[model samples]
Target: MPHIKQILCIEDDLFIGEMYRRSLTKAGFAVDLIASGDEGLKAATNKQYDLILLDVMLPEKKGTEILHALRGEGKDLVPNSRILVLTNYDQDDESKMAMQSKADGYLIKADITPRRLLEIIYSLDVQSTGAE
Candidate 1:
């Protein structure tokens, strides 16, 4: 059997977070859905996850701040985890470029369906595991 991957989804919208959680869980992934940026950051720092699905506009703290902290000071704690910026916010070029630089993948939430998200996650897993 293939190893089940763990995912951390940091999204403020409860509906969207639930959707992602249900989809990812149904697809055999263990998912932890956090609705606030502060809590999400705490979770990310406390636990090691295979992938992190981050949203931009969140309560308490912005996703960019969390990303910056993770890629900067928290890098050692999550060295092997892949951070993916999944946001619906239309950020400016500079912000987008900065996020892209730090993240393993940058995707617009509105543009991608849960199925496509799963495909992307699977692809990332394959690449990381060196599996064809």
Candidate 2:
């Protein structure tokens, strides 16, 4: 049997967080849902998660800052974890910054469905694990 993947979902909105948690859990992933960037930063930096689904706009701290910190020197707890930025923003600057911060992928929240998001997660898993 294959190992069940662990996922961290950092979303501030209660509805969005629950939606991601439900979808990911139903897909057989062990998912952790955090409502604020502050809490997410601590969890993400201390735990071992296979993937991180992050929202750019968050309370206490922004997702981009978390991404930057994780990708920066001396603070990469889950350096090999795939990070996918899920946000409503379409701003080029934010996208550029996220890409520069080494985020694996970026997707607009309004443009994604749960099924498609699951597909993306699976694809990323394959890419990271080098599995068929």
Candidate 3:
């Protein structure tokens, strides 16, 4: 049986966040949507989730900054929880930084559909399981 996943979606845009939440929820994943970077960072550090959908440009803190902090010693993020950067940005400096900071993947939001996003998450599940 496929394991049910819990996902944390950190997006400042209301429309995008809700869309992801609704789609992911319908796809059989438990989704937690956090609108602000600060709240997202707090939730990420305090809880263990199966996957994280992170946005780059956010209020209070940038997603790269949050990824850096989580990958560092200060915050305790789940080691197995896949973290994917979901933003409009492409392979720019910010995306490079996120990759260097241990982001599992970086994807342009405009280029992906919700169904494809779910597929990527499932692929991450395979990669994560193999890594352990």
Listed in order, each prediction's TM-score against the native is 0.92, 0.88, 0.86
Q: In candidate 3, what residue range of length 10 has the lowest lDDT sum? A: 72-81
- lDDT of all predictions, in order shown? 0.88, 0.83, 0.83
TM-score of 1: 0.92
Across 1-132, the per-residue lDDT of candidate 1 in tens digits comes to: 133388999999998999999999999999999999999999999988888999999999999999998896536456768888999889999999999988889999999999999999888888777752
lDDT of 1: 0.88
lDDT of 3 by residue, 1-132 (tens): 124388999999999999999999998899999999999999987887878899989999998878877886555455757789888866578557745468778888999989999889888777667655
Query: Which sections of candidate 1 miss by over 4 Å?
Result: 1-4, 73-76
The model with the greatest lDDT is 1
Query: What range of 10 consecutive residues in model 2 has the weakest lDDT sum?
Result: 94-103
Task: Give residue 26's lDDT in candidate 2 (0 to 100).
Answer: 92
Q: Encode model 2's per-residue lDDT on 74-114: one tens digit a residue.
A: 46657658789999966688556745467889888989988
lDDT of 2: 0.83
